[model samples]
Target: MYIPAHFAAGPDVIRDLLTRPSAANLVTMTSQGLLATFLPLIYDPSAGEHGALQGHLARTNSQWSEPAIGESLVIVQGADAYISPSWYASKAEHGRVVPTWNYSTAHVYGKLAVHEDPAWLGNHVRQLTNLNEADSERPWSVDDAPERYVSGQLRAIVGIELVITRIEAKAKLSQNRPDKDIDGVVAGLDAQGHSEIAADVARARLGS
Candidate 1:
């Protein structure tokens, strides 16, 4: 979350981060303290215009059951890579630098509301299921399942709608480093075959 202006991500970056159509780490605080769960997330940037986010959690998961409805954090993590100190041109000249992580992360702080309506819950699950299966060679569909069985399963979980009050996003992709250092780091990561990290570094370079 400590994002330098040079490393700061824009709205396009934030939208792209969630558009990965992936699950996100959600954290909520309760009387019991902090609870975190990985849940598939759908963000409507338009929702923020009205001050809200809509998502759901399984009722079976106690993370949503706490009587307290405080602000929650939804984290979407994108590609990340390790930047070795050795990759920094400065490392050879000054030897004052240490290794760092290059990554993209978004934080959504919002109001949490839990819903139990069967219709709403069913839609939530169905959308999530579709999103998860969208990229599969043979994507699965909720309609593919027996209605009675799927309905029973939906009853077992909880649906939540979070109204996002704020969103902070940062791509720590070595913007703090000199161009030569960044090139060296990207080259090192790519050469090492750390494809994920390398991809992130590449994206960061673009964003920066």
Candidate 2:
């Protein structure tokens, strides 16, 4: 989350990441220690100033039962690739370039609210399903299953709502590097079948 000015991502970028298919690491500090869960969240931009996140945890999970310690953090990560030192013009010129990782990430801090209502859980699950299935030609829906089965599934989980207090997003896509080095990185990533990361690096360069 220590972002330099060049790599800082704004509101639009954070919102886009949250709404995508990225899985978030939900972290909370308990009296015993720190706990984390990996889950896909439903982002609602209109719900708050920074937007709200919705997800669920298994009923047996101890995370929900623990008292809210401080602010909870949800980390959403995007495409990332290893940048080789050879992918820099400076490497050949002065042999001063070093390897680094190029990636995009967002840290969302919020207040956690847990809910056990079956109706709320069902609705949240439906929304999450629709968001992820939208791109599929034949999208499956929660209602596609039998009513009894769906209700039983809902009972096995607890719904979570995180009211976003703030967000810090970063896109370390070689923004600090010169245009020549960045171009080389893009080329290398693309050649290695990391088109997503390559595209992100290109986009970052263009935005700069």
Candidate 3:
């Protein structure tokens, strides 16, 4: 992650990236080579020194069975959008502005831990389900299925935990732009329906 100091994410942004309901790409080095999986993860702040990421993989996914060599990584990203020079007030003033991108992301590195116990898997799945389904009109739960069927489904997957060692995150949300330019960017992004990244850029501007 090539993060300029001005583009570095604040602690609040990092916390949101971790705690928000989302998915990340988990990458690990194996004896064969590098393997990756996009997984829905939850931040477990109580798990370790720096906490851990909890998720699961299907039993058939070879990546889960393979022993990860050295440190593993999980890439978490928030909203990203294209920023046109046309959106910058400076573009009209000097015609020197160029197009760019605005985004927030984190590189989480940690040791991998696998769990086969049905009890742990059951608890993990329930937490994950609740987190994602919280906004739904009628949320689903593990208990919604037959006990035997749920147990069988759990048996078909393996739980994975990434005990965090470190995290490097960046928020390239036009924090370096001047106030007038940033205002233009926010308005342009909102008009384009990129509300999330637009808000991120607006927040970054205020933070700066």
Candidate 4:
């Protein structure tokens, strides 16, 4: 998260990115070494001062059993696109511009808490399911399966709750570039079928 002043993201932006459709990389340090897992997380902004995140991992995953030393990190990544130097107005003016990347990302640091109770795990899974399935024509639920089957499935996984301590977010969407150069970036990205990144760049430009 090497965020320059102009690229620093506020709390609202960070929370929005965390709640979006992004997979988070959960990293923890143990006596043996650093371990990581990729999973989807649900952010509950009302749960704590900074916020809380809920996720689950397979019981066979050893990373969950190890003691989380001090703080753990969860990285949420958003749309990204490469910005070619040819898209910058300065490139033709003085050849001063170089290629770079434009992207949005957030790092959440928190204290890890593990839950093994079947009821708790079931509730977590249900919430996660609903959140992801909301946009579908027919949503699926944990209760859709047989009671015994659902219980067995829950038993095979462990629930994780991270009480957030702090968050660092960055949106490197060409904020440092001139207006014409940013416009070129948006146009180039959109032409390259990266509408998400182009939209983000446009939004950042309007915000600036």
For model 3, how does the per-residue alpha-carbon lDDT over 134-165 read when each residue is reduced to its tens digit?
A: 99999998899999999999999999999999
Give a tens-digit lDDT track for model 2, residues 158-183: 98888999888998889899999988
Q: After superposition, how far is residue 91 of candidate 3 from its true place, in Å?
A: 1.0
Position 9, candidate 2: lDDT: 85
Worst 10 residues of 4 by lDDT: 9-18
Estimate the TM-score of every prediction. 0.86, 0.95, 0.98, 0.94
Please write out the lDDT profile of model 4 over residues 1-208, one tens digit for every residue. 6788999986666767978755689999998799999998998887678888989999999989999999999988989988999988888899987889888898899999999998888888888889899899998877889999998888899989889999889989998889999889998998999998899899888773
lDDT of 1 by residue, 1-208 (tens): 7777877888877777866677788788889888888877766556556344556776668988885456788888887777799988898898999988888888888888788999988887777777778889999899999999998888887877667878899888787778889889888988888787676667677773
Better candidate by lDDT, 2 or 3: 3
**Order of models, best lDDT first:** 3, 2, 4, 1
RMSD of each: 2.4, 1.3, 0.9, 1.5
**lDDT of each prediction vs. the true structure?**
0.78, 0.88, 0.95, 0.88
Winner by TM-score between candidate 3 and candidate 2: 3
Rank by TM-score, highest first: 3, 2, 4, 1
Better of 1 and 4 by TM-score: 4
Name the Cα RMSD for model 4.
1.5
Badly placed stretches (over 4 Å) of model 3 are none
